[model samples]
Target: MTAASTGDLLTTPDDLFWQEHSESITESDEELLRIVGSADLPALLAALAAATADTSFLSGDLRPPLTPVDTVGHPHGGMTPLQQERGRKVAFAALKRLRDEGITRARMLSEAETDTILEYLGNGHTEWAGMLRHELDLAPDKNGAPDWRFEDVAAGRDFTALIVGSGVAGLAAAHRFRQAGVPFAIIEATDRLGGTWQKNRYPGVRLDTPTFGYTYSFAQRTDWPQQFAEGHEIREYLETVAERSGVASLIEYGSALISAEWDGDAGAWSVTTETAAGTRQVRQFNAVITATGQLDIPNIPDFPGQASFTGTAVHSQEWDERTDWQGKRVAVIGTGASAYQIVPAICAGVERMVVFQRSAPWMLPAPAYHKPMTEVFSWLSRKVPHYAQWYRLWVTVLGIPGRFHTVRAEKDWPGAPLSVSPRNQQVRDELTRILGEQFSGHPELLKHAVPDYPPGAKRMLRDNGVWAKALTSKNVTLETSPIREITPTGIVTADGTHHEVDVIVYATGFRPSEYLEGIEIKGKEGIEIHDAWDGDARAYNGVTVPGFPNFFMVYGPNVGGVVAGSLHFMLERAGEYALKAIREVLERGIKAVDVRPEALDRFVEWVDTENRQMAWGQPYVRTWYQNSRGRVSQIWPFTNVEYWEATESLDPEDYDFLA
Candidate 1:
């Protein structure tokens, strides 16, 4: 079905919109039932209750009726089991009433009624209602503008945007531009579209997050072949999404942006790019969005004598697809996220695989990893309205709030050294227990498996028992010792042991803190952005920099929510912000709009203060979030909602709009 007219959605109140969409909801119920696998009222009620209860990190700003009520129908926490049971029964009854009543609304719900429904579905979270609205596409476009109308109005603009990188972020930006009826072109460095997915072709490369949550919000996919899809599958999905969204044809493959310099006189950015044919081309755009994500440059550490090694050496990002991995003695260094997936995939085929770990990553059990969706389930999810949304929301919510609490440092809390707080320590204990159980037979491996740092300090590796099993394999060895050097045929440890191997795979991660690694971005007044930040990138709302006029970054500094939500969500939010800024420039007939330096500085300071309390900011733990100077260049250390609010509107005072 086509999307409802944007005019109708923008003018109508949210409550009214919901009330009017009953027929739409009714039409979806059959598919929804199919998705849920049963029409049993009790089963559906139970599922809804479970999902609502599963959501934590309540915003605490929900209206009165949406506030949590104890078992006795009083608003508060800490109710007894019987009281909780009563509350569940009450909620289930309400759900059954709504379900049976056919959801037809003659008029909009009152504030109280709206709050009640939010309470039932949103589980007392203030943010849930809005999220649901967004999922339903009932929410207005950026800054309360209607989608189609905005496009019509913006079609007259003479402005153009050049988006670097054709990954999810680039594609998201392109879609926004298309929706706004703006002229744009996407420049993808590689021959293919998928950025990281195209580059990293290592065996068993799969997503760490759930498929639904990882996919774009606007372009939701229900038939994702697998729960946690492989890289290639996701890449293909991205291509399909781009095509469906009408942004595919706009992308220019095998083109890389070398530098972007803002010309004060021309009021535009002069961007230099090199195509695959060894030809350099210069293009000018009114606005330029740097969608080159953090994972572009694979950071291969300079291991001593690494070049002298007489073996096939490759970074995991640059894995040679044609190389026969069979019978090869593989030496995989760096046991991070890439290594976690790589070891499991290559272990069975390789004669011997040595996994070198600098620090053990936090491993959590994920039964769904590597599990494919049943055909029926896939069909239901694709066809069902609100089915994929609910499921994805549930999966996405599970990772936040609870996890967010554990990461923040608690002052003087016990286990402060090992973990930031008691909740974090509990996470450590739980993960430790799992590690113990997994490596119970091998005490030596267990000792090395358990990380010394806090749970969220590094990325928590999703364990489907595959990672543990790979590590404990007969031919696999986990080495935590410091590497003294890489000899001709093997890796030499500090303990004087040489672990010989036929191939060396560097599963090292990317240079995330180093934004736009190779590209030189010269902002207004010949100020090089790379030199301005001085190796520590900072941005206002992670989208705009002070000197950069109409120059934006999609997955920029302080936008990496490593411990929280999906990157795709953050990218969309950032992309919308950038698009909004461009819209402002065009609508106002401005030459360029540079974010006020004072405003940018204040934002950076606030971010620094907030990050200081986060797990990544703790002095005891070290991760890629921080730069060489120990400043947090990556990771937004707050709730995703906060970032959403900050980016929703462009504050005119924060920018200098030139006419």
Candidate 2:
């Protein structure tokens, strides 16, 4: 069955087109189409008559009709099913027409008008509105960049910055520089921006985090249809941000950075870019920000006899969208985040899906996994001031903070390996209850789903419940045995059991250890970045390195959030820091500002020590968080606030400044 077009799904074409193709379509045309599509002529006339009569249907306790109500039956209070359906349709059409013409309308205000409507909607909850105002930068002193002065910097010199990659992080950095009145150019390896979002376009690929929280703080999106957005929506959002922020023109599509070297005498880094036209051009820039994220490269595990016998094999990241799996017996490796989402989505379509589970992940209940937002809820969200903002804040504090708290070890606890303390146990117990409730009739299924490791030892998966239900289905099978080799037909286990399969999807995550490994970066004294890192990636605040002067990395090593906080928040912080660093160079007449080796070392030491106290660093669980040497090097070990404070200001003493 073909999926329904996005146009048919939404009630208002104005909102739908804006959500889907805002950059492409005209707003007035979209609104006109929406009004015409929703209502009939009779309903339109009724709405006009109602408006003229000053009749109001708007109410705080408004709810959508249960089935359908007939206006003809209003005199007698009873009507046929067909009459009820037709009258309800006409009434809805009338409402749409009246709304479109702006005649006796009840609509919500935009982000700019949120403050004025706060008193009317807040109902004496001034603190909530105050917080919303502060967050949205409607209030004074809440400007995101307090340190960087655009006028002073723009007047000094025409300095240039070389930004690597055109993903969210890179796009954000470029925007920050543009806002700061700095001349910069972005070199992207691919022909498109959006980084991972642009690359990973698998059938069911979507963000685990909510869209509102995932977006940049400076650009708050008020119209997310779903709580958690899909990959296409995210990519569109990034593209919109780039175009609107004026960063789209600055990006050189199909331009890959081959190498970057610092010149002590010139006091600039020479960057080489290989364009799609097969020509190489070298440009000099005063600063560089490596915004290449961690998960760009795919990590495919080496299984024995894999090369000899294969029907069709592909990684989750490198998903072949065109590949047909209609009646094919498919084998899925790994039960991680990607696998969790992918399995359930494709289970019904495939003939047989055999999932190879290495370890079970901690699954938290998510009721909104499959539920779509009701029209009433959407209307309420738009009408209510500070409601959506407060909901987002609640999610940030309660949902995000508890994730960090679960990782910390406590002295007294019943379950040593499963939980660290009483609070941790409460989390585990809640998860257990959710699992039990989901698999009420089948205790055996619940047993298989329960994780043995402590919560947050690995990435906690949002529960779909469909995964458990799918496993219990007749066509699905879950295998825990180790695979010895892949035969011509299928996989062979260590126990000499052969499970035949037509296709295989390796959901094994990215090689995060090889951060910026492919890029050839040479600093002063002819030191390559790869050699400097020595396979153990470390950075001062996960932005700047000691050897690579004037070179910064956004979403770099140990800078990722451990809690449920958005990755965009980290990217924003890094961008803020980059702006500060660039401003200092232009103002102070400094040629290069390399991080002090001592400071970088101390920061790495602190990251390591802090991670040791978390569950990801525990000896039992094997995750992508560690390097080959078994050191925790991927995730940040502190709260989101700590990172915000650390990168909010730039201290000159942290770096070695040279004339």
Best by TM-score: 1
lDDT, residue 29, candidate 2: 41
The models' CA-based lDDT, in order, is 0.71, 0.67
Query: RMSD of model 1, in Å?
Result: 6.4
Where is model 1 more than 4 Å wrong at Cα?
1-117, 138-157, 374-384, 397-402
Using all chains and alpha carbons, the TM-scores for the candidates as numbered come to: 0.84, 0.78
Q: What does candidate 2's lDDT look like per residue over 1-659, in tens digits? A: 11111112222211111222111112254453444343222222222222322223211122112111110012112224454445455445444443444332222223333443332223223444533332432233343543455567557565788889889899878877777777788888888889999988766787776566677655556567776788888899888888877788888898888889998898889988887788899889988888889987888778888987658888887788887777899999989888888888888899998999878777766657665554543442343222344344433432233356566776544577777666567777878887788778877667877888777778877676777877777788888888999988899888888999998999888888788866789998999998888878888888998878889989888987755466776787787787788777777777878889998889899989889888777666677899887888889887665676678668778987888
RMSD of each: 6.4, 11.0
Alpha-carbon lDDT of model 2: 0.67
Q: Which ten residues in a row have the lowest lDDT in candidate 2?
A: 67-76
| lDDT, model 1, position 392 | 59
